[model samples]
Target: MTDNPAPAVVEPIPKWHEFMVPVLRVLSDGKPRTRRDSLTATLDEAGMTEEQRAVMLSSGQPKAENRIGWAMSDLTRAIAVAKPERGSFVITDLGKDLLQKNPYAITQEILRNIPAYRDYEPQRQNVSKADPVDIAVEDSELDPTEQIERGIQLLRADLATDLLKRLQERHPDFFEEAVVKLLLTMGYGGAENRGRRIGGSGDGGVDGVIDQDALGLDQIYIQAKRYAPDITVGREAFQSFVGALAGRGATRGVFITTSRFSAGAIEYAKSIPTRIILINGKQLTELMIRHGVGVQIAKTYTVAEIDEDFFE
Candidate 1:
C-alpha cells in the first residue's frame, strides 16, 4: 500500500466578536442564561464537542478564556451587554441592534459604536501601528536598542500579568508546578518531581528538594503551594521554611506558591541570611512560558531593526 501523508490541520482563528455573537443571539432570543449556560449552549450550537470546548476554553493560547473575559468586560461596559445577575448575562438593546446590523462584525466596529469602549481601541491599535514620521521622530529622541529592549520588557510584564490571572482561574496546580520548574530551569536546582509521595513522613512545608549542582554537593529546599484567589503567603510560613532550610544547612531556598506574598513576608525574606527567592503565581506562570518549561511557542515574529550603516 502507498504511504498516505497526514493532512495538515489548520487551527481556527478566534475572533472576539464571533465568540460574543452567540451570547448576543441567545440573549436577543429573550432567553436569559447564566455564563455557564451561555458558554455550554453556544459551544454546542457551534458544533464543538465537550473536549473541543475544553481545549478552546483553556488551551493557554492567545484569545483563550482570559482574553475572552477581557473582551466580555469591555463589551459589558459598552452597553452592548448586561449582567442581570452574578454569572448570568444578556444582550442589551444596543447589542441586539448591532448584532443584526453588522453582517461582518469586527472588534473595531463594536468599539467605535460604544462610548465606553472607544478609549481602549485607540490604545490597542497604537501598540502595533507603524508610522514613518512617528518612528523617525521616536528614533531621533531615543536610542533604538534601548527602545526595543524597553518594548520587550513591557510586553513581558503584560504577558506575566495576563498569564497569572488565567492560572489563578484555571489549573492552579499547574501554577505551583510552574514555580518549581522555573527554579529548575533557572539552574537553582536539578530536576523537579512534584507531588512525589515521600514515605510515611510529610515534608513539612517542603514539597520538593534539589541539589544546587549535578554532583549533589549542596541541596536547596522548596515549598510548593496551590493557592486560590486572594490567598497570601504569610510571614509565619516563610519563617518555618527558613528554619527548615537552616536545619539542612542550605543557604538557599525557594518559596513557590500560586499566591501573593504578604508585605511582612517580603520584608522578612529580605532581612534573612537564608537566600529566599519568592515566586508569586503571576511571576511563576510568566517565567514558565518564557523559559519554555510547560508551554510551546506556536508562533514566532522576527522584528527587524533598521540598519543605520545603509544610509552611509
Candidate 2:
C-alpha cells in the first residue's frame, strides 16, 4: 500500500490588532522610544522571534518595512507619532493618550483625534473597508489570467511613476541621457561619433544627425527636448522641427521629448511624410524604468506557479 502524504501546511493570517497591541504595550510601559528600542523590547517581552515580529508588524511578509513606512506617514499626519530626528521615531503626546486606552481602539481613536483625518475619514474608511470584499468577489468572478494581466499593468504604471520621481530627485542629468539612449535603442541615426559633428546650424530643426549605416552614407535627423511639467510640445514646434528636417533632405526625423505632445502636434506630425516619432514624457519614463536605465530595484517579489502534476 502507498504511504499517505503529509498534510499541506496553511499559513496563518496576520492580525493588525496583534501587531499594534504589542507595540502599544511597549510604548505604554515607557515614556517615548525609538522604533528599534520599542520593537526590540516588544519582541523580547512578548517572547517572539524576529520573523514573528516582522509578521506582526508587517502582515507576515518581508514587505513589512514598506508597509510600516506608509503607516508611519499616516500616523505622523494624525499626530500620533513624530520623528524628532533623522532615523528616529517616537510616540507623541497624542499617541501616549491613545496608548492608555484599549489597543483595539487605536486605529479609530487616533483618526478621530486628527481634524484632517476626520474630514477624509469617511472616504478613506470606505476604501479600506471595501477593498478586501471587492478583491475577494472579483477574484471569484474573474478569470485568473485577467487578474494577472490587470496586476501586471498596475505594477508597470507604478514602476514607471516611481522611476520618474526618482530620476527627478536623484539623477536629473540621467533623464536626458535616457531619452537619447532610448532613441538610439529604437534605431535612430545619432549613435556614431558619440552624437557629435553631424548637424550644423541652419540644417533646419535637426539638432543631431545619425547615419543610417556604418559607411557614413544616409542620415536621419533627431530633435530632443528635455521638458518639465506644464511644458507641452505644440504644432508650431513640430512644424519648425519638420522644416529643418526637410531642409536637410531627410524624410525621417525622431522628435523625443520628456513632456507630452499636444493633440494638434501629434495630428500634424502624422499628416507629414517626415516620419516623425514622438516619445511623450509618460511613455519615456515607462521605457526608462522598464529598461533599468537609471533605476534599481530595492526589493523583489518572486511569484511561483503551482505544480499540478504533484497532485496527480
Candidate 3:
C-alpha cells in the first residue's frame, strides 16, 4: 500500500468581501447573536476545511475570523446589520431586504449603492479617475485594513527594487560602508556607534567591523557584497568569509549582499560552528527600510477606533 502525502498545511481563506453574504445568511432569522457565536456559525455554514480555518494573518488572528469581522463591519456600515447590544449583532430590515435580493452573493458595488455606506466612507479631497464599477470590484477583494497593508507592501516592494538598483550602481566601497552603517543603526556598534569600512587593498577579507565595547573585547565582522540582483553568492564566498573570521579568531560574522545566496551557501552557514548571519538582497533592502537607512517616511496615518472605556 502506498502512503498518502500529507495534506497542505495552509490554504487560501475567503476574502473579506466574499464573507458578506455568508454573514448575512447566518443572521437572516433575525435572531440576535453575539459576534463570537455569529462568526462560529458562519464558519460552519461556509463549510471551510480545517486548514482554511486554521490560517492566520500576520497579526496572529485567524484569517477567516478577521475577514468575517470586516464583512460584518461593511454590512453594519451599509445599515444591513445592527449591533442591538454590545458584541451582539442582528439583521436589520435593510439587511433582510438585501439578503432577499442577493441570496447567493453580494458585491461591494451593491453595498456602495446604498446611500448609508457611501456616506460612511471617509471624505477624501482627491477623486479617483477610475470608474466606480471597476474600483468597487478591485477594492472588494480585501477589507479596508488589508487594503491599506497591501498598498504599503506594494510601495515598499517598489522602493526596495529602486534601492537595490541604486546600491548596485554605486561603488563597491559605498555598499561596504552602507552595510556598516546599517549594523551601527541596528545597535551593534554600542552607544557611540563606532564602526567603519576597511575594504581597501591588503585589508582582511572582512569588509567591516563593529566594536561592541570600549576595549573592543567584543566585535562583529561584516562582509558586504554589492553583486547585481541576479547574481547569487555561492558557498565559496561563505568559505572565504568563514576563513576570514577564523583568521581573526572571531566567532560571529554577518554576510550582507545585494543579491541572493545559493542554497549550499545557506546550508553551509547553518552547519558551521562559527555563528554566521546571511542577509540577501531582499532582506538587506527590508532592513534598510526598517532602519530608515536610505528612505524617509512621506506620510503617516493613524487609525482610530471607539474607546469603550470612556463611556463607563
Clashing pairs for predicted structure model 2, backbone only: 189-210, 190-210, 204-244, 205-244
Model 2 weakest lDDT span, ten residues long: 116-125
Best by TM-score: 3
Provide the overall lDDT of each model, using Cα atoms, as 2-decimal numbers.
0.60, 0.57, 0.83
**Residue 91 of model 3: what lDDT?**
96
User: What digit string (tens of lDDT, one per residue) describes model 2 on residues 75-192?
Assistant: 5445466555544556766767766665554554445555533322222123453332333244566576767655555455445544443444444344545555655665565446
lDDT preference between candidates 1 and 2, better one: 1
Task: Please write out the lDDT profile of model 3 over residues 151-209, one tens digit for every residue.
Answer: 67645755665576678878999999999999999989889998888898866899999
Off by over 4 Å in 1: 1-70, 73-177, 190-201, 302-312
* Residue pairs with backbone overlap in model 1: none
Error of 3 at 300 (Å): 1.9
How many Å off is the CA of 117 in candidate 3? 37
Using all chains and alpha carbons, the TM-scores for the candidates as numbered come to 0.48, 0.50, 0.55
Count of backbone collisions within predicted model 3: 0
Best by lDDT: 3
